[model samples]
Target chain A: MADWLSPAEWEAVRLSLRVAFWATLFTLPLGVFVAFALARWRFPGREALNILVHLPLIMPPVVTGYLLLLAFGARGPIGGFLDSAFGFTFAFRWTGAALASGVMAFPFMVRAVRLSIEAVDPRLEQAAATLGASRPWVFLTVTLPLILPGIIAGTVLAFAKGMGEFGATITFVSNIPGETRTIPLAIDLLLETPGGERAAARLAGLSILLAALALVLSEWVSRRVAARVGGR
Target chain B: MLEVSLRHAFAGFTLDAQFRAPPGVTVLFGRSGSGKTTIVNAVAGLLSPDEGRIASGDWVLLDTDRGVRLRPHRRRLGYIFQEGRLFPHLTVRQNLAYGTWFAPKGAPREDMGRVVEMLGIGPLLHRRPAALSGGEKQRVAIGRALLSAPRLILADEPLAALDEARKAEILPYFERLRDEVSVPILYVSHSASEVARLATTVVAIEGGRVIAQGPAAEVLGDPAILPAGAREAGAVLTARVAAHHDDGLTELDAGGIPLFLPRVALAPGSLLRVRIAAHDVILSRERPEGLSALNILPGRVQDVRPGDGPGAIVALDTAAGRVLARITRRSAEALGLRAGMDVHAVVKTVSVAAADIGTSGAG
Candidate 1:
């Protein structure tokens, strides 16, 4: 894998893939949960939860990364608790990059999933309840299957967004080789130096190829789910 | 028996109703906004009423005074909606099995093959709901509801969305369920003919109140309590197929008295319930010798009830059953028709449409 590209470029690509994969995989479940609650459940603090879930999307990505650092830094409350209780820290680490990407990608995934949940007919759920299924079983057997295509779409969007995440990842975990230096950060570094345009162009092309592949994969998966569940 | 008493207040309407449905098909009959669906929803726990005590047999479903309320899933009622809300993502086979998964493990298992054969939906098991016709979807909906092994069945105008042919197609299956299965049903409908064909007991709703409640024969025999007055009044008569003539006439023995109608397709000895509209019959004092009407039921008038208009509904206790005749007050005055007068009720042979005839019990 290192024969075609320089070692530094290869390291950046590998780290970016690792960060995006873990970020998207971890956020999928929580994204779906928040989406279902926002679309269906009504309680005293529902709107407050809605605004909280969407806060990162509306705020600037650099500000979001700073807030993450404040809450999860080594001396921060949560970071210090983890350092004493679990002996772990996320500051200036690859894990911090993943967390930053996931936070930046949360709203995209949730909004897609929420729209699908809202499109489902509540009467069908009522019919299921009358057939003797409890609320959770009704969601598992009927509602979940129907919204699968949307979930897949949201997952792919979050993954792509994570791969291109520059502002938050660079802000939270300072650029470093083989750890925090993802594709976008590496491209920024290469462009700032003289006689590094060729390396930067190759990395930029790789970014386009990776994003296009993600979209194609997403389309294929969503098509399969739609065929399984769509009435059309 | 299923007992329901509920009170609900809407913006401009108030629904206060009470009725007891014995084992059979009990129809909630009324106009569109008379709160028939509201009562059914309350019984199914779809909507919470302001105050209510709903019970089926000894099993209490809802009691506001006792602070006891069961959710819809725990109640185990099978509801058939007007639109036949089958899950579009599931095949017909899975839709039928969905309820069985949630049904009690030791409960009586409804035979899938029997229900499949009954509704003739075996061929459609692999197809999605989007591929089914309106009638076919409803047939599967009925099969799905039955396979749930429900304690009670609630049908909210299950046939209202279909055409006349489809209604005719589904009515027999409902009759089959009522006769073959002992589960009590609360059926909602505004069609007088549907009530005439399906109901064993009738509870007529008007202005969110139960105006009358009794056996189907007794309620349907009275024209004044009918929602549409004389225009929609009809009598349901139980009869037996006596013979089929070569001249395209089917003769029925109505309580040991032979009555003729257009050719019925049933074989001899088949029990049938037929609805005779009140406006279709004419009354005469003396036996008319040269009359073309084939049905001449000789019975003494039980009573004559005058309507709000110039018409009158005469309740006649024929040997067949209670029959109603809608006639003008001028004609009643001219004929001097009164109680205890023996008169021949004349009925046209073609007046009984094919939609009005239904088989009585299990085939």
Candidate 2:
């Protein structure tokens, strides 16, 4: 697969896959937590929490990246405190690209998962409780397994979205070749350079193929999980 | 014994009910929108009543005055829902074992082998709930609740979702549960036949209030307290199987009167509770000649409760404990049917359906 493209183009593809994988991996637990809270719980400021989670989806990707930079830049308070106290930094780093991608994809993941969680009948949970299961135990044994198909669908969708993320990644971490220039960034660079149309076309085709493959894989997995959980 | 007194008001509806149920199967008998499910939920701690106290013997589950309320998990009640509520992700075996996983340690647990045998779910244990029929799912649900070692079981129309064939398939298992298991059951249902067959104690509720409460026989026999215009109004009789004739007939002794019916499927000497519908019984001033009815009992009229319509319900003190005859007011007056009047209660042998007969192991 690498031999088919220029070294720079191959590097972009690898970096995109890595960033998307990490983003999905890191955000799954939090995504499930937020989704469950939104689907099942009621408390003060619940609407505010919902809006906050969805703000990135409604706002332009560049604005979300700028917001992330303002909060997590090297000179920013949180960024400075983290660098001084823990020797950690996210400014212009590959991790910052992943953070941007995760934020961009977070709402999509939460929406899919929350719909599935809401579809679960609460009467089953009540039945579990009356049979001596505690609230947490009920979630672990009953609610979790029932909502697993939706989680899988959500995670795969977020991963696919992360793979194609460009506006947020480029704005947050810039278009460095190895550090953060993912497939979309490489395509953008190839399109702008003089006499670069051929290379640009190849990279663009690769991105489309990869994205389509991710979508197909996600659909296959969700279908299988649904069949297993739905028992027919 | 379980004592429940609860009051909860919903939009356009209010529930204020109080009743004491004995250790046997206490049925919450009412119509749809009659707050039977709400009462069950409150007792299970699934819903909180505005002002109420629920206790199972000494254990106080909820007491609004004292500010004591137990969560559903801590209440140790087993609930069987109308749809069975089996976890779709799990196999039949896993669903049955779910409650056992949460059952407190060192408590007397129901043996898994016995439960599997009783519910006859051994074959389906390896299969998922989706593969089972409605009757099979309910049986598994009952098994799951039983293995929880619950203080009491709450069944909210467990068989209501099934067809007549499935209901017939599951009713005996419930009868077995009532006779064998020591745990009390609070069953909610709207079917008169179900109530007549299962309830040892019947608590009749209407419009969110308990209109009547007593032994099943007392509450079911009197048509005046029965649900208005209930066509299934009947009387329950305790009888022992006396003989099984070769011509496909079984003879039962109801308080020393030979009551013959088309063959019942129980061994001789086994106690049976038979529900005789009032419409099936006829009254005559004297011992009437055969005219096709097989059973005739000599009894005096106990009470004649006249209805607004042409019908009158006459309660009788017959050898079968208590029998009721729904006769027309004109016939009742023409025969001078009153308290202390001697009459022969005639019942057609074929009108006594096999579905109305229930066997009790305790008797």
Fnat of candidates, each listed: 0.87, 0.90
lDDT score, residue B318, model 2?
88
lDDT of 1 by residue, A1-232 (tens): 4677799999999999999999999899999999998998888899999898889889888998888888888988887898899988788888899999999899999999999999999999999999999999999999999999889999998999889998888888889888899999999999998998999999999999999998999899889778778654
Worst 10 residues of 2 chain B by lDDT: B223-232
Q: Tell me the whole-model lDDT of each prediction, alpha carbons only.
A: 0.90, 0.89
DockQ of all candidate complexes = 0.75, 0.83
Model 1 is docked with a DockQ of 0.75
Docking class of 1: medium
What fraction of the native alpha-carbon contacts across the interface, defined at 8 angstroms, is recovered by model 2?
0.90
Candidate 2 displacement at residue B249 in angstroms: 1.6
